[model samples]
Target: MSGTVTLGMVPVVLTALFFVLADGQITNDFLIAHLLAMGVPVIGPAAIWYWDARVFPTFVDQSADLAANPTAVQRVGDKYKAIFSTRSWYFVVPWIALIVGLTVLNLGFFETVGITGAGDPAFWVYLLFAAWWGLITGIGLHGAVTAVRAIRAVGELDLQIDPLHPDGLGGLSMIGHLAIWTTMLISLGSLALPLAFLLGTEGGYRAVVYLAVGVYIVVIAVSFVYPTVYVNRRAGEIQERELEKRREKIRQLQTQAANLEEADGDTGTIDEVATRLEIQRLRDEFNEYDSVSLYPLSVGIIIRLVSSLFLPIFFTLIDIYLGQLL
Candidate 1:
């Protein structure tokens, strides 16, 4: 992981160094823009990989373990295989298509803005960088999908679900620790370099910022939330089954107690008393289910996760407005 990150950042660091070295000696707009373009793919993937290292350690660890032991065909292992297999076409195809589409759009935008001449080296450089950015973005997205799959695998594990536990999802609370929202935030942050370049020069391109933010919202929804839908549904099913079993037991106790009372014409008999106590115990057990959540996250945690997603957009708007003011 460290090696991948270091290697990925080499181009970006070199580009930055070049700009600094020529800071006062050169004033060519196309040259500087081309250098910045060269930095995009380099910085983007490195930032994404570093963020994943910090926020999604479980996914990283699992991936490493699977890579080390490819023959381990356990539940989680099989799912990991499926994630990287032909099923991954769903993610890969769309990613490539979007990249090609976006590259064309970007080229058209440059032409419309009169920023590129027909034979300009910067134009071709920008095209190359756009394609590179698309590839890196696709790689990051594939990682996100893998992380989601890892989260789902957690639910399939033989975890104990204790109704009395604080998290309400047994020890499966780690499912919430997936840091999905954090990952999404980091992914957005990786685009900061290119976004900064665009926003700095193109005053009329505020729409582009909004479009990026909107697309990020969709990505977050699909990557972070969509993958967990199955986990939530499975949890609910488990909760229902457990509750029904307990409820049936309680009902049986109640019926037995009533029969005892009818036979003796008295409610104070020992058998009736024992049956009542058992029913009370069963009811308490049944009520314990009330505390268990269908999903691993609490309301507070969910609110935090959601808030983190929008904070970037909020800050971006502020930056744009502040830029206008200045």
Candidate 2:
């Protein structure tokens, strides 16, 4: 985090120096917001990689029993390992181009919207901020792509129901928590957007900022939810598959129970009765497993995710509203 703050400070210091040297003033709000928005996106990928360090190993161990074959875990690990390679580093290059390209286009659009501040901003300000956003966004996209793909690779493994899991989420709550952590960082970054208002954008400029932020909010939410949705489908499939198997067994048990009257003697009748009782016992146990959860998340964790998405945005809005009122 401190390292990110340091990277964040580079733009702040340089932009400030440029504005002060050429124009004699800099907006404190833009300075703060500009630093914050870029910083948190960088932090998002770091948090993901940190969580992956732990989540990957634990997920591998927890899902061992559910894999289609003994080698399934190893196969998935190789796929995951591929992500750490230079081949994967290539992933960020295109993101940099896209983000920086958009930044350049927005600069042109903002020019038409009119610069409300001292003349037009120095070209240095444009170059520095755009490069910073491009770099941060590229790094963030790298992490987002890696995290989602790793989870999907795991999701492709055969899901066997594990009702007896201590977490009650089939040991998959870590995944839910991982996504929650990601979205929380994104939300925190969004809080910085409202502060950009302090930079003094007006008319079309304000509308564009709001539109971009709104679209970004939607994108972040989708990024956060996609993995959960993927894993959840796998969970439901496993539950239904396991339940159907037990239903087949129950049908067979019922057929065997119907034949009790054909037993050879009292001893045979006793044995037949015992077999029916045992099947009934087995059926009852699997029925419990069938009732287990079909999601890797708990109700409380879901609430946390919801809060992470809306609370910061709401708080920032209220702060802006009240500030305007005052």
Best by lDDT: 2
lDDT of 1 by residue, 215-295 (tens): 876676666566557767766776677789988888888888888887764544888999899888878877877567656
lDDT of each: 0.57, 0.62
Error of 2 at 142 (Å): 3.1
lDDT of 2: 0.62
Candidate 2 regions with alpha-carbon error over 4 angstroms: 1-22, 38-48, 84-91, 98-126, 195-200, 315-319, 322-326
What TM-score goes with each of the models?
0.64, 0.76
> For residues 1-326, what per-residue lDDT tens digits would candidate 2 score against the true structure?
46645665665565555555444333444444555555554455455455456655565565666676737866775666566444544866676676556555455434432333334566446556566655555555555566677778778877566677777876667567656655554555565465444332532356666776677678678767898888888887877777788788877877776687586789768877887887887688677777676666788778877886785477468547744664
